[model samples]
Target: MEHVVLTVQSQNQLQQALQQLDSSWLNLPSGRVLAQVYSRNLESGWLLSVSAELRAKLPNITVVGCSAMGIVSAGSDWNNATVVSLLRFDKSSFVATLLQSSPDDEYLDGRNMAAELAIKQRDLQGVLLLSNPTKLATTRLLRGMSDELVNLPIFGGLAGDFSQKLSTSVMLDQALSDAGSVIVAFYGEALRIKTFNYLGWTPFGEGMTVTSTQGDVVKTIDNIAAYDLYNYFIGIEKTGFFSSAMEFPLMANHGGKLVARVPIAVGEAHELVFLAQLEPGDTVQFGYGDVNSILSDLSFARHDLISFGPEAILVFSCCCRQSFLQDDPRAEIQPFEDVAAVAGFFTYGEIDTANVPRDVLNATIVSVGFSEEPAPAAEEDDWLITERAEMKMSRNLNRLQRLMCFISRMTEKLNAKNQELTRLAQLDSLTGVLNRRAFEEQLAQEFQHCRMISAPLSLLKIDLDGFKQLNEDFGHAIGDQLLCNLVDIVNRCVRHTDGFARYESDCFMLLLPQLHYGEALVIAERIRAGVAQSLTIKGIPELPKVTCSIGVAKFHDEQDTLDALLSRVDFAISRAKSAGRNCVKGE
Candidate 1:
């Protein structure tokens, strides 16, 4: 339940840090040691040697660590610094497992490791993971663990080589490698785990719909090349896209929370490659991180840890955050020390298992707090400085959000108005069905398609039985209502691809592609019955019944010109009226 942090500048200084670990209070016979090592400019062998030497000195201590580009401990940022965090649980047992995996099959390796550790699944309370970011798919590895260990809370980060050379190393029990992963699963009843993952990225601009994706590479966004979309919206040169895009990554709605997806590298084919997968049809928006929002979220994280009353807190912060807040990355970790002892390293992507089984995050800060005894609730005013800063930041963000929302609403209204105008141009003013011009244009297009594919195409010409008489009896108002009512009925009874239009004052047209003469006759009969059954005057509910007579005709490439086909259907309609007022006749 207690921890000692050892910060060293060199190997000789590391010996001094070891003296701090030998305090008498931690020298119990049953005491177990957990140490996380962070070093810079050091070879993997020397790091392993340090771990081995620690094991030789402490006898029963377990060691695990990774190469961190930046390390945080005791309220300060340490760039190219080495830190050794020592923890000894006073009342609980510790079980450690170090897993080695090939970069190609890390998913299977995760499943196997979970299966091997399944025996202690029930006893597991928390998990700490460190892995090589370049060699493994961060999301797939976490998914494998989530599938097997559904109830355990997992938190950790990807290892970072300070030199940015992809030489990250993960060490467990004297073994270290830059290509595999290491997991430290904690087993005890006294372990209390709570994690907070916060992304302060503001979403702006038009949202892009994901149209095509292959695994982790998003190929086309909105059916355009992903690279082109980024270049157009971001307006950055191809060489600077990666660095500039980091300021505004893509944010998606995953399980009702915004998760940022960082594009690591671009492919030669112009794919925006990410460490996570985005499914087609998911809408993503470009997001920008601001200092006020970032600091506000950090303050909230510290407050959350205070409320949880944890004895120690471990951070798995995104390296991009460091780059964004380059002058003062320590602002994130400094406040946490006010609540508990703090230690963590920068990661390429952070894993947050506090919510559902779906919590792999980027451009976020993931804080995990550990506690054995619950601390009494502290007054809200205890952290007043941070609270005021948060309040001020929230107000500013709220105002910005409100203004942005207003502009967005106005933009949406304008877009909706434009859509309505376009719709009106193609629709009849009275009946709300396709106008003569639109219907004829659609007919020509459908005819060309049918000719190309040799598909069946049918047309129907419908005339009201007594539209002129109805208008004379009840005036044009009632006549127009009857026409609209009949159009509604026919529309409901036909396929969406089938076209319906108000061809004239008393005549309607229907285009049925992929249908023959017999099929068209059946549809025309259905429409006749529907109109006869549901017809009524809008205000006068039971005034009069409205009916229609329909004539059907099938298209023939050799015998039917577009004009000839229309004339034939009109002739069929005349015949239907001659045979009976309410009937369907075909030619």
Candidate 2:
């Protein structure tokens, strides 16, 4: 495989770049050639003329491109110029499709396009997608395509317009559409594709829940107007809202992965409109780009790309990243050139279908690497040397990154300790069962939940029969062991869903959700039988016989308070004790 990347600012520059390509390589009949154009200039007339000139020079090549906020070439990025990449593959072939569909028909359009691509190429390896973000439902389209092409990798981006007019275009040869998609499907046995994506945004501040939404418009966050939430956190004003918000996007978990969503506009009612949909109940945190973290992530990506050893690398990075990394916009793009020829564009949104439940990402960089050959083996020393040479950062930035990392680690440790303390507080120190207060709290919640679901709930109140007398004879230490032993026996007999708690000294309660009175009685009998078997107490000359009395009661949905349930169960236990020890009673 071979690739050439060049930048052109005019028709004359385009011709000169074409002349620089090897004519023999371009005319190779055995190899397939394709050209990709990423232009900041969205003028249809100029782009068409460039396309016509490319065809006149190299008639056998396939051409596809889109309008970009910024174009990327090997080792650099351009704000107002076009970057053209010509790739020649030795054993790979591809086909391109232009889907002209309305925004409302995006889902169906995606499904149909994927189906056509699948049928057209039996050896389909991957797909490259470019679409107009302003006129397409990107998430829905990706979902539709994902449903049809399961496990197939899709990598590309939405066309971007720097003018913010929301007008973007995708091209297929001489045809260009401002409101649809152009898909280039690559297929061949020898073709290999691997995708890597990273987000350098670190989440900060308290998490806010999505309270309300209308499609892609987020109406409220944490029950406050969406715009108000932004203002409260970042003091963002309506003027230049999109640009400001791009610096700090809302990071939320989508399909178990963190994805960023940039607010593009503020609605009349102060709702924030995003390019991607925000579902109600999603917990989001405000995130900002950290330069040190960004550079560190690039090192990881660089390692993977070096190992893959691709002939060409295509990048679909978010335009917001370009804006945020203004001081060094080419930091992420330049490293890939060390491994292979690189070309891409800064996009409105990036589509990554490599993982399950494909995501349309914001403030991320997604790199797609292509190779027709297997990866070459490299020693660990070589990787370390390359990583050390290429991975460079300012001293102050590195120190700041280390400080942030230190704080993040310390915070995690503190949270873990807090959680452990909470767990310890809720548990009985001796028997490791829920203590009285925690059990009561849990019972109240279980009661409410069972009532809401109209499900049965049962409780068993257990007491070691003659426990006080036993403790008086055996001493407190032995008595505590007996209590722990009984707990172990009860645990073996009860279902996993049963919640056992130490109600008081020598008394315990088991709260069972979705269990009827009959089932509860059976479990109580099992505990009684297990306890009656015998107690092998240490230092005891003879094995002491031990037993427990249990009372079972089912919840009355029509009129059962937590206190009432407890009272009835206690009364039933008293009845069991009055009848005889080592028995079960039910109410």
Candidate 3:
């Protein structure tokens, strides 16, 4: 495989670049040739003229082009210019197609396009796609394509426009489209394709739940207007929110992976509009670009590209990343030139076909490497030096990264400590059981649940028959130990679903959901027997045998309140104590 990357500023430059290609290789019937044009200029007439000139010069060349926010080439990135990449393959072939589509019918359009491409080549290896992000649903379109092209690699990006008009265009052969897609289907035994993406944005602050949404517009997050979230946290106002929010996008878990969503506009109701759909109940965190992390990831990606040894690399990087990286926008793209020729554009959103079902990503850089040769075995020193010495970090970036890490770790520790405190507050310190207040809260929840489902619920009020006398005789320390031992024995006799609590000094309560009076009575009898046999005061040869009086009461009709149920259980316990010291009774 042979390829050339050139930056063209005018029609004459494009013609000159095309003239540099070998005419013999262009005319070879068994060879495949592809020309990808990424232009920052959105003039329709100028683009059309350039397209016409290319087709006139090379009639057999497959041309796939799109409008770009910025064009990228080997070791450099350009704005308000065009980059052309010419690829000639000796053992591989490809078919290119253009399909007009409507936003309302994007899925059908995608399926139709994929179906046509699948029939074009029998040994389809991969696909290259370019579409208008503003005029179509790219995510749904990718899903439709995935339905037809299962496990097939598709890599490209949405056409980008930096002008206020926001009109993006794509070109195929001699035709240009503003509301359609262009696809190139590559097929051959010798062609090999690999894709990789790097997102170095670090998520900060607490995750907020998406409370309400309408299509791609998020109305509220954490029950407040979405705009308020950005305003309060990131200090971004509705005015120029799109540009200001570029540095900080929302990172959410989509399809089991953390995908970034960049806000394109703020609505009149203060809702944030994104390029992709977001559902309510999804958790999102504000993410900011970290220079250190980005460079670190670039080091690993550079190593992988070197090992793969591709002939050419195509980049589809997010425009937001360009804005975040500022002066050094090509830092991520320059490293690829060491292994292969590189050319692509900064996109509005990137299409990553590396994952099954594919994903439309924002604030990410997607690299697609093409090779006709197998990778060679690695040398011992090949992995030793991955990062370049020239990639130095600024003092401000280092301090910012250190501060971010410190804040993140502190927030996590504080959240963990808060959760532990909450759990401790609900438990009894001595017995490790639910305290009276916590038990009542749980019992109220269970009561309401039983009422809703019309299920049976039983409560057992247990009292140690001689707790007061034992406390005075054995001292309070031994009495406390005895209570702890008795709780362990009773816990063994009950199901995990049952709620056990220390209701008072010598009284305890057990809540049994979905259980009737008979089941509660059986459990109460088992607890009485277990405590009698297992509990014994230490350092005393023979003290009064530990025993408990249990009163089990089943919930009555709809009119029965929690207090009324407790009253009945207390009466039952009074009867048990009057009859005998150690016994079980039910009401």
Q: Each model's RMSD to truth, in Å?
A: 8.6, 6.2, 5.6
Candidate 3 residue spans exceeding 4 A from truth: 28-31, 75-77, 378-403, 406-408, 411-415, 418-527, 530-587
Q: Residue by residue across 281-329, what tens digits does model 1's lDDT show?
A: 9899887775556666777777677778888788888777766666565
Looking at model 1, the pairs that clash are none
* lDDT for predicted candidate 3 compared with the true structure: 0.83
lDDT pick, better of 1 and 3: 3
lDDT of 3 by residue, 201-307 (tens): 87776779999998778999999999988999999987777778977999999878888989888888889988777789999999988766677778877877887
Model 2 sits at a Cα RMSD from the real structure of 6.2
Q: List runs of model 1 lying over 4 Å from the truth.
A: 25-31, 39-46, 49-57, 74-77, 290-300, 356-359, 375-587
lDDT of 2 at 583: 95
lDDT of each model, Cα atoms only?
0.77, 0.84, 0.83
- Indicate whether candidate 1 or candidate 3 has the larger TM-score: 3
The CA lDDT at 32 in model 2 is 76
Candidate 2 residue runs with Cα over 4 Å from true position: 25-31, 42-44, 75-77, 290-296, 377-389, 394-403, 406-457, 461-509, 512-551, 554-584
- Model 2 Cα shift for residue 554 (angstroms): 4.6
